[model samples]
Target: MMVGRDVQFAVDKKPCEVGKPILEVEDLVVPSKVHKNNAVRGVSFNVRAGEIVCVAGIDGNGQSELIYGITGLEKPTSGTIRLEGRDITNAPIRERSKAGMSHIPEDRHKHGLVLDYTLADNMVLQRYWQPEFQNHGFIKKNAVLQYAERLIKQYDVRSGQGPATIARSMSGGNQQKAIIAREVDKDPQLLVAVQPTRGLDVGAIEYIHKQIVAERDKGRAVLLVSLELDEVMNLSDRILVIYEGEIVGEFDPKKTTVEELGLYMAGAKKQGEAKA
Candidate 1:
């Protein structure tokens, strides 16, 4: 639900609190042996049930590093990360995934999907090892196809061959759609969406935005990291502006200006760097 400039009298002032478990990061820090500096100086934030918190900032300022740190791709040097109150900071990547945290990496072509697999197969890749799509430790082909078809239609993937299409042959937009459709459909307690709408056309961007909001509406906690200024400004109920690997500002869209947001995003300003 988007609101205009005078958004106070808007609908649904109450935020959603359902879908999945809550995600909270406390004083997260990442060190760099290469640069001899903290890549993420000290970052902390929260993604509550049914809320989308967008991390807005310029690139080379640790935007990419932050998402990687959260997903266990890059182990943090310090701090605690919790999903539904379980400390996951030191947990391995697979553990985080099993804990119901799904991450759509920034480079979807490289990390989000497997080019060798068919779209339908890639859609259920996260769960192939699980029992729902498998029976007696054997993959149920028809059940897999059914699950993939449902997500493709629901998220609007429009390849000519539909869910059976090879991921390598799909258009960029369709690839993104397929990944989003799969990851979101998995219905994780915490969703790490990194630059999800980048390289997507306006229509695809719009569709993805609605889906993210829909997740929040359904009470899923989403940690969104995007370079699109308009996307972050429009979709985030609360904004966390990251600069130099640390969160520098926090604002309620109902109480902040885009210009003000730009300052924190660009490192021209830093409102506060308090603990979460």
Candidate 2:
């Protein structure tokens, strides 16, 4: 018999009124592996503060490339990307992060964590240069340890060795939690979460969902890319369906059905022009 709290997909809290767009992408066209084709074709959208906007599509419909363009993993062939009205289409990854963008990348192992590093070390990977964690070109070990412990406790990131545990030794859920805790703690203006709950158990998914919603309620703009329709519906205020590298339809989750979304995702239907 099961003996655990029921998983709740919906958070009881709602965000404050949505604010102006913090992330603006216009005519984003990422080049594909082949020289002639664009992987992301003229994708345009804006994510407002205090709202969750989801890019919903089947796997391999240019979702990965789209995220790459946004997060600086790949430069777009042509487009403009703005953060708080400043153009950053060709900015370096670190510059984007410094501009208040935190990315919970889709492939945790590939882009999220340094498996060989201790949990505490990985916790401050993006933040070590700050005065709090570094002084006189040296790491503040005690401060880092204290900070890591606090986040692990708050986020319930379980590991046998605590902060000293090598990230590779932890389970997938714990690793994901570590990433989320680190990213969310930064208090970014824009949180780009790509497949945040992929491969996690129900309990872990529940916890992560709550964290994302909590961020939204705190007035952070969230750009979520996911293949799961239920996650897209439950967590998003707005959904943009991407098919064949273009946005085919935009829907308000409260007003659209899964069937309608699927039709757009499958290329069976499309709106005349998907508004941002």
lDDT per residue as tens, model 2, 235-255: 899999999899989999989
**lDDT per residue as tens, model 1, 1-276:** 332233221123355554444888888888764587888987878888877888888887887777778898888888888999899988888788888888888998788889978988999877787787888888998889999888878777887887778899988888988888877777788888999878876666766777777777877788898887777767777788888888988888768888998878877777754535
Candidate 2 weakest ten by summed lDDT: 1-10
- lDDT, candidates in the order shown: 0.81, 0.93
TM-score of candidate 1 against the unseen true structure: 0.87
- Per-model TM against the reference: 0.87, 0.95
Checking candidate 2 for backbone clashes, the offending pairs are none
Of the candidates shown, which would achieve the greatest TM-score relative to the real structure? 2
Top candidate by lDDT: 2
